[model samples]
Target: MNVLITGATGLLGREVFRAFQKNEWNLTGTSFRRKSPGLVRVDLSQPDTIHDFLNAHLPAVIVHTAAERHPDVSLRDPAGTRRLNVEATAAIASWAATHGAFVLYLSTDYVFDGTKPPYRPSDKPNPLNDYGRSKLDGEQELLSRAQKSSVILRVPILYGPCETLAESAVTVLADQMNRLTEPTLAIEDWATRYPTYTPDVAYTILQLVEYHLAHPDFHGIVHWSGNEGMTKYGMARVLAGQMGFPVERLVPNPAPPSGATRPKDAHLDCSALEELGIGRRTPFAEAIQAILHPA
Candidate 1:
């Protein structure tokens, strides 16, 4: 089997790359800004190039992890976000459909409007920001274009094995805490996020891919998320204790996040994947410990 992973150098994509390394399949990873020995540099933002690029390889499966994922960044450049998130995704799915390749698109929890506590695969999405809207659009693009078996895996707030502490939304708190010379950050205690582990998600992706190979009929949207829900303040306190930083120094802002409007609680109902026995989740504190205090 030939498998292509976009954004192979990203926080989640890197782990997915590692997970597939032990497999027998012919695997190729794509990187944009960053380059490595095994990574093929490709710009996903250029929709015109995506078709020729994928058609050249025609991988049996494609793990489309590339996207302009930052909420504030998306808001700042809505056109750029849509260019990659929706337009580029459309090109990929269209090519996959014609070539009979299965696509596994990595989506986000921001697709839901925070009013809903737990969203199911069947729920109607009402995204609050440009990032969520673009992702939702990408999901629609994939479903409509990919006539072959495809899966849209919607996950939330990923964190694990980052090159820099500021790489992940979860680990960025540690960076904020590191601003010893500056005023403490007012971390959001308002919105609840399920900080899912990337290695665990990578494992789940491998299981899904293997299961999908046997059952090509397994097509549609599925949710995978951490069972534990916590606010930034809650996560910060955990990190503070782990890092030996004063918990009292961490300021908790009970208000909603300042930029890029977010849902209060877009907690995904991960039963679809969980029911298939194709999921693994590491506890937030436990996983964060490994990243913060790597032995």
Candidate 2:
């Protein structure tokens, strides 16, 4: 099967590519800024380019992972976010619908207001920021166009092997902790987030793809996330122990994180996918230890 993965150079995309590499399927991972030897450089921002590429590849399945992932970044440029996340997705979905190609769109837990915990796939979304809004719009675009052959997998904040500490919001905490200029660093303790492991999400996607192959009628939205919930402060404390950072210097602020109003807690309910026997969760401490102290 010809499988195309967008944002192949990204943290999650890279892991997804790695997961597929273990299989016999023909995989094409797309890249943009951080182009690699194997990845194809395809600008998802260009509709014509997407059409041309889809025509050439004619992939049996497409794992769409490209998007304006950060909330502050999306807030700074709503137009750009919508163009890439929504408009580009609409174009891909339209093309896939006509061509009979299956699409697996990656979405976020941010779509909810965070007022409710463990949000199901059926829950009505009320995004607090532009990033969430854009992702929700992208999901709507895909579902409307290719409801039968598309899947919207919504997940929480992700953390895994990354090029830099800055690649993930969760890993960036270590960078912040290491380069602290002040006497103490205050981390947000108000908002609770599930720092999902990327490798696990990759595995889940692979299983779902196989499941789809077996059951042609399997489509629509599903959720997968890390089981454990922790605040930035909690994560920072754990990293401090592993990296020998000063836990005393790290302060926990029980106030909402400033910039781009976020949900207090947007824990995604993964039961939808769990019931189908498609889920994985690595212990937070163990995963962080492996990442920080890799042999």
Per-residue lDDT of model 1, residues 1-295, tens digit only: 8999999999999999999999999999999999778999999999999989997888999999999999999989999999999999999999999888999999999999989779998899999999999999999999899845789999999999999999999999998898777556678899999999999999999998999998988889899999998999999999999999889888889888788999999999988787789899888889989999999
Per-residue lDDT for 69-105 in model 2, tens only? 9899998999989989999999899999999999999
Off by over 4 Å in 2: none
Task: Evaluate model 1: give its lDDT.
Answer: 0.92
Once superposed on the true structure, which residue ranges of model 1 sit more than 4 Å away at CA?
A: 182-184
Question: Which pairs clash (backbone N, Cα, C closer than 3 Å) in model 2?
Answer: none
TM-score of each: 0.98, 0.98
lDDT per prediction? 0.92, 0.92
- TM-score for model 1? 0.98
